[model samples]
Target: MTKTVETPREREAALLIKAAASLQNIRDTWPQDFDQLSKALTFNRKLWTIFMSSAAMEDSPLPHQTRQNIVNLGLFILNQTRELTMEPQPQKLDGIININRQIAAGLRAMPA
Candidate 1:
């Protein structure tokens, strides 16, 4: 029997999807599980932070434009997270969730 090993890209995609689902879950159960929002948002912020840092690295394999885009998107996500943290609004989660899912999809679609 042969076992397939997941590539780093696949792992990153999975993590992004997980983070999106966690945020969505907290949003869906808003008001009831407001505390959970902190956890979800923390995870998401940390993930994006890592991504941005990697993309910002000079040796990063991604194209210059792609890396810049990641950094830009990461900045947006961080700002959105800050707003959500202050306001605790359910609707504010849409952009973060959408970005995570979209980025994850793109990551997964790439040839590995």
Candidate 2:
């Protein structure tokens, strides 16, 4: 059997998908696992923070509009994450998963 290697973009997208899955899992098993939900949300927030920082870099190859859009989305995630942290609602995690999945899909669709 052969293993496939992923490009940087593909790796990032994979991670996003994994994170989304984790969020979904937490949602599916909500209330019974507050600790896991908090951990998942924290991890997701960290991922978005790194993405936002990378997009803000001057040497980033992404177009200005694309970078700006990512930054805006990151800001939304940051705010929503904070709210979720305070309220700890399972449903609130859906928005983060959807955003991550959407970005991951777009990344996967891009040519290497």
Candidate 3:
């Protein structure tokens, strides 16, 4: 006989998987600047908390607007997650310095 999964448990598992994937993507993308990525992750967590809390509060005259704000915040968090996962790792200071020198040389060579 085949085993069946419960819908709630399945959804929970999927969410966990998605979170893990996001973490790994961020790690891979920002290997050198984990601090910035960590800050973004923390901000996303706070946004999620606020969204849920607002959703649970009693209805009011501004309930619809509040719900829309929550949705917009959720989307913002997701976009941040995606961005943190896509940014390339920064170069070392020495490498950055050398690149700046090269760009300066090229700019100086350009005609006015």
Candidate 4:
């Protein structure tokens, strides 16, 4: 058996897409599915936290401006998650879902 190794961008894209799918699924079955909201949001939040931490690292491969942009975007995502957790609205997840999918698509477009 042979295993294919994924580049960092591909891995990140996969994670983001997975998080987005989880959020989207929760959104689809919301309130009745409220029990799952915290789990989904927590996973998404932790993923963004890891991204922010990596982007903030001094030795990160990303350029300073790009790293800063990622940190800022991560902050926005964190805030969005906080708001969603507080309110538990299905519509509130739209922006987060769009951002995740868009970022994932961009990551997937990058050359290895």
Q: Which residue runs does candidate 4 get wrong by more than 4 Å?
A: none
Clashing pairs for model 2 are none
Error of 1 at 73 (Å): 0.5
- Compared with the true structure, what per-residue lDDT tens digits does model 1 show for residues 1-112? 9999999999999999999999999889888888899999999999999999999999999999999999999999999999997888999999999999999999999997
Which candidate would rank higher by lDDT, 1 or 2?
1
Q: Which ten residues in a row have the lowest lDDT in candidate 1?
A: 26-35
Candidate 3 worst ten-residue window by lDDT: 91-100
Ranking by TM-score: 1, 4, 2, 3
Best by lDDT: 1
Error of 1 at 1 (Å): 4.2
Task: Predict model 1's lDDT versus the native.
Answer: 0.96
Each candidate: RMSD: 0.8, 1.3, 20.0, 1.0
lDDT of 4 by residue, 1-112 (tens): 9999999899999999999999899889876887888898999999999999999999999999989999999999999998987877899999989999999999999887
lDDT of 3: 0.48
Q: Residue by residue across 1-112, what tens digits does model 3's lDDT show? A: 9997645324433443444444454555656647565554554455456545665567633467756765665665555545545763433222322332443354345443
Q: Report the C-alpha lDDT of model 2 over 1-107, residue by residue, as the tens digit.
A: 99999899998999899899998988898877777877787888889899999999999999999999999999999898899888988889889999999999999
Q: Supply candidate 2's per-residue lDDT for 50.
A: 92
What residue runs in model 1 are displaced by over 4 Å at the alpha carbon? Answer: none
Quick one: best TM-score, which candidate?
A: 1
- In model 1, how large is the Cα lDDT of residue 16? 98
